[model samples]
Structures are given as structure tokens and as C-alpha cells.
Target: MITAVVGMAMAASGCSAPGPDPGGATATSPEPGKSISNAGETASWELLNAAEITPESTVLRLGVTRIECASGITGTVLEPEIQCDGEQIVIRTSVETPEPGDYSCPGNNMVPITVHLQSPVGQRQLFDAACLDAETLATAFCVDGGVRWRP
Candidate 1:
């Protein structure tokens, strides 16, 4: 009787499904530093900094914050120009604008930036972050993933 009860308990516990894949919680790109294939499409994003920000630039800093993937998605920031040294994605900005007519600014200062990134799809669902205005039209999210937007 005791052996039968133990076997039944073990079976019941084993029948439960696996909780979740922590890896899938965040959206990341391919391992080789190239476009990632997901949801039947290739995905990538451009990191525009404040120093490089021009009058026509649409991107602006949203304050420094660490973002985590909520669930059911994963992605990465595909920044080829900036080098990711060690575990850091370094962003450099100078007080002086990179070019003339960049913006009407008094102080051009250098700022270092690092991002805790997931795929666009992961970020969209995790945070209320998204591209504002007409940029939305060009962005897309996987139906299964949260909300991946291109900014």
C-alpha cells in the first residue's frame, strides 16, 4: 500500500508541465551579430543618440532604465556600428553636436549609454515603450510575441 501511494504521488508531480523558458522571456537577435529571424521576418533596430540627434532626428533619450522581457518573446539590439565590449553596449555622445545644424544646443557633452535590450517584440509588451508618431507604421510585432516595434 505504501509503495503504491508513493508511485502515485510521483506520477502526479511528473505530470505537471514545465513552468517556462527563462530564455524565451526576453527577445534577442541571432548569435552572430546579424539580423534575427523570427515570426517569419528579419528584425533589427537603430540606436540614435542625443549627441547624434539632429533637428530632423526623431529619437530622444527616455532616461536611463533597465528593461526586462515580460513573457512569450525574445529579441536583441542589432547595433553594428557601436562595439559591445564585454557585457556592455557602449553609447558615446559629445556635448558638441557631431555636425552643424544638429540642434540648437548650449552644452554639447559626452554621455555614455548602455542598454539592457530585448527584441522589439519583447520590449513593446514588457514596457509601454514604442515609436511615437509616423514611425509606428514601419514597426511590427510578432503576433505571438508581446509587441516589437522599430524605432
Candidate 2:
């Protein structure tokens, strides 16, 4: 849940679904601080929360608040970038936006992004890189684990 503060006022609502790919989405486990594959240049979004569909499943539905910046443009969620930092599986979100121009985006709401991982998560800890920043980690509305989640 988010409260009004500053210039940001967010609405919460969403659904989880597989990516547009028919064969199912694929993810990469790049080293920390390295860029994982994504579309165009993107911005990072912190996870409001996350849940493993099943204990053995590698798929995750990452809770996020989407900021819709244009009326005609859709699919604001870019593919998620995955990373492995020691004993943790770092999940990062890349937000896609159209080129700057006259636009109207009246809604900012929550969306659960579904991602597919190559390996079963098992016991690995989950972390959100966007929330891991030293400056924001403490103040960021991250999960109870302080940017990390345990199943």
C-alpha cells in the first residue's frame, strides 16, 4: 500500500500473465552490476512484493505500480532482468516508455509482472535491485526483508 507524498500519488490494481512470447518468457542470470537483456533503454522499478507461483516453479509475479505516461502506448513493463548475487536471486524490472512527445497518461496503477526463470528458485533468496540502493533502501516501500524476500 502507498500513501500520498510529494508529486507521486499511485493507484493499485493489476493482473499477472506470461509475456507476449508464445514459447514462454526466458530470463538470464547475469552477474550483479551487469546489464541483462532488455528492450531499448529502460528505467528500473522496485517490486512492491513478489510470490513464487509454486515452490518448484521458477516463475514469479512481481508486484509493481505502473506509471502509464501515454494514452496510445501500452505494455509499459519491459522484460525483467535477473541477476545472481552470491546466495540471492536478484530480480530487476525495466520500465519501457515511448519517445518524448505530447502525451497524456492519467493513470498510475499496480501491475503484477510475470517472469520466467531458467532454474527453479528453490531456497535462493529474492532481492530487488531498485530497492537496494543505499539511499532509498531504508525509506523505500520495500517488503519486510529490506529489499530481500524469503519463501
Clashes in each model (backbone N, CA, C under 3 Å)?
Answer: 14, 0
lDDT of 1 by residue, 1-151 (tens): 0000001111122211222223344333213223211222122222324354332322333222112221212122222122121121222111111222333323222222333222111111121122221232243421222122221
RMSD of model 1 against the true structure: 21.9
Candidate 1 TM-score to native: 0.16
Task: Please list the residue runs of candidate 2 whose C-alpha ends up more than 4 Å from where it truly belongs after superposition.
Answer: 1-55, 66-75, 98-107, 143-148
In model 2, pairs of residues that clash are none
TM-score of each: 0.16, 0.51
Cα lDDT of all candidates, in order?
0.23, 0.46
**TM-score of model 2 vs. true structure:** 0.51
